[model samples]
Target: MPVLNPDIARAFDEIADLLEIEDANPFRVRAYRTAARLVLGLSSDLKTMVEAGEDLTELPGIGEDLAKKIIEIVTTGHCSFLEKLEKQTPPALTELLKVPGLGPKRVKALWHELDVETVDQLTRAAREGRIRSVPGFGEKTEARILEALQAQIAAVPRFPIAVAAPYAAALVRYLQNVPGVRRVVVAGSFRRGRDTVGDLDILATVAADSPIMERFTAYEDVAEVFSQGTTRATVILRNKLQVDLRAVDESAYGAALHYFTGSKSHNIAIRRMGQDMGLKVNEYGLFRGKERIAGDTEESVYAAVGLPYIEPELRENRGEIQAARAGHLPKLVAMGDLRGDLHAHSKASDGHHSMRDMAAAARAAGLEYLAITEHSRHLTIAHGLDPVRLRRQMDEIDALNTELDGITLLKGIEVDILEDGSLDLPDSILSDLELVVAAVHYRFDLPRGKQTARILKAMDSPHFTILAHPSGRLIGSREPMDVDMPRIIRHARERGCFLEINAQPERLDLVDIHARTAKEEGVLLAVNSDAHSIHDFDNLRFGLQQAQRGWLEMKDVLNTRTLKELRPLLAATMSR
Candidate 1:
């Protein structure tokens, strides 16, 4: 036996897998999902509770019986129930669970009738007009499947938000280094922290007489040039990624920045404002009464319009222009105000560092504290463990906590919320943990009502503290699971669950508009890095920028709390 600890959430996923197979009770399923999420966020071990024979009811949604199961897994490698469930179902179905709009029902249909079991097999069937014959599937649905397949093939692989973040930084780096380029920067949805960016947008200023355009087209990275012009260049680099670089004279830089760094709606509003002011706006320069005033930097452009510079998150034309004009712009949160980090990973699961190393890195970066939110049992591919491992990890965390002088390390699990609304682990294991970050993993396309009920049920647990990246959007890769955002925000507020502003470039799930709406509705937020490596810390600044654009403040975030204060918040949430 593998000595599974009841507290280790790694096995929670196995239970979720079992539930998906049995098509278990949605709310009960979400309990396991919640447990998985809660465990990843907590600093404690399930084995400790198992050893103490504790009840999971204190952890929320977890009763004494379920807690016993968690202990069973920790001391033994397998649970009899999960093992029995697995015997009746092919584990391979789990791999097919992620296709958009395709749920377990559809997967079962293709499996039982068509004997299709893989993406390639599904693709072939769709191409051959076989999928429509499956019950509940139509010609249109098959066509949609083919389209998604082709899109999947033609599209860039899903780069985690963390991976894409650096490309923007790299582009900026080059622009800053280029001669005559004085104010090079990244602008557009990427600047605003949209989950995915189309092509890179860079804005810069140069002396009117400078050969910046010529220098750019001939730059070392240039491979196949799409277009070469005086103001902009569109080129496909050796890596096959398209990059659009735009240049402007110093006098027109500011207006151009505002124009290019647009969510389109914000730009239209600005243009209207400019027209009212006897001016015009474009990616070139601002024309005011046929003559331009200040247009070199973003600062001058917003200032000219009688407004503070708008953050990128608010640049989506979502009342930001009116707010700026009315002088009702909410005070934006700053990067400096963030005092802690709420999510991170380590070698204990799929992360790259040790617990001590991750904590030390957080401390070195001047963070007040951080959470060691590793993957729970449901993420077996990521090496999610059972309760025994979770308990041992807690011991390591406790020891490290004592070693730190000022920085406090938190126990947190990035638990997987099963399709049925249950969490990955049992309740007995959850009550003693500090933080729970409930997340969605499988069955993303359930009916909206079902999905909503699923998450809401997870939140019923007092142990549930934060809703982590609720939408599960991987920018440029997938759309958010269908759910009513307003209602979701409202629920979080009522339940005291903090909505996350995930700092991953691709998964800045709660951007300004969402964050602002959340803030306006009294939702507490914690801007988290979801950092998997030490270098991922840089992504925090960008995430915070988007949070500021949402008009969040230090007080709205959990990471801003000192350890002493944060402990109470966690305690209170558990008690609730």
Candidate 2:
């Protein structure tokens, strides 16, 4: 068995969850949690490092004990520490952490008080009106729990795109290395760049004698082979992500790719277009009666239906077909189009790296300028900067810029938008910065009207430049705050401040629908990494994918403009 970084990271996270549920030391729990994050964010493979006998303790937040645990997980595919913790607490209690509003503390309370060790037990308790009496849980909390549980039950388990990417990329690389394989591609929601992916649809064009299926099932990470055939096979990975692989002939590769890389509605719409033209479309090819019309390329498939080639990200049947027909399809923003990132952080706040390191990283990532937006005073958990600390950091950035080249660092703060709609720090200090990435770090449960008003009021500030992670959502964990997003977009257009399409995988907020609405409203959106470390800049690709899905073009994105063009636009937002 090959242990990936995510495997090690998951072990650490589960250890943290179990520790928390046992009411263990908070610092010990935080240490494991931090170790998990560090593992997940590493660019290189931990297994490779372990194989090379590298010292893991050199990694941030990875101390002597934690380094040993990492080696144990990598070498043995299990963590003795986590196994021990699981024995002290019901291992299933960790699954309760998946429920939106339930944290480990709540799980512990449920376990000790209500004897609720699983979601099913919690669900029954909530339904029987027994949860309301469980100390901290009230009737409303119980009701919300029931609703959340039901939603969870109804939803298919989908991996966040970030979580699934490594597995998908590793598999693609493995298959590509197999003898007789010509090409391999992962197409599905992954191709569409959806925030969460249900499964991976992999297609390979191979020589007739290819042993792709045999090798695929034999891959180290494959947990179980569901079915196997010469041309097609299905399996589940160790992480439980289902994957389907198909060996396609070169002649029909494009058609197979398009068929599998689909939103069902989009595929149906394309098929109907083919039908109207007296043609048939399927996984193999597009045909007019007995003759094949198009199937060799995705462009040919679209041309057969009298449409231009639609980008996979736009293949959601969301007016894309109509736009293509009218020749109004957007060019769509790409990773190369971005000129700078407006929302980022450093060690001055909760970020793991310093401004100098982050700048060099942004330059390496091809950005001409990077904004170091540390969290402001209100977020103590992040060691957010006070006005004095913020000023000192600004001075540091100014000095670093004098010694640096290629990339410029902009001084800024991710100042909290207070409950009453005022900035966390006073305007006097905020006005001194190049930008303010105003955000809501707390009070996510406000009424729709109040939440919208709070955000709108914050944007009213002359110093406010962009709203960071505008919905404050963490996919599969935290739901988006209740608010009128269209109203927020319209207000942003009216007010001059921009909304952010935060690129962080967990917080791809200002989702595709909202991004499109902002575009429609003629409001520019910044597809920012909201990066906390150098590796986070890689997340910008996810943001770009999200923007493409929203039908955004380079001109529609704020940060796509060069620094010279962006400063004036940013200035307009700040002094409006």
Best by TM-score: 2
Worst 10 residues of 2 by lDDT: 34-43
The 10-residue segment of model 1 with minimum total lDDT is 1-10
lDDT of 2 by residue, 236-310 (tens): 998999999999989998899999999899999999999998999998899989899899999989999999999
Residue-pair clashes per candidate, as listed? 48, 0
TM-score on alpha carbons, each prediction: 0.72, 0.97
List per-prediction Cα lDDT, in the order shown: 0.73, 0.90
- Per-residue lDDT over 1-576 for candidate 1, one digit per residue giving the tens place of the 0 to 100 score: 222122244357556755765677866666676565445333344656666876655553357766677767666645677667667776666556556657667888888889987788888999999999988999999998888877777865433323344445556766676677777777776677655556667777776666767766675556788998888888764434567888777777777777887888778877777778887777666767667776777887877767788777677777777778788876667777777888888867766567777777777777888888888899886677567787777778898888888778887788888877888877666666788887887777788898888888888876798888878776544688887778889988888778898886667778567888898888888888887666566668767876877778777776777778778877777777
lDDT of 2 at 16: 88
For candidate 2, give the lDDT of residue 390: 88
* Model 2: CA > 4 A from native: none
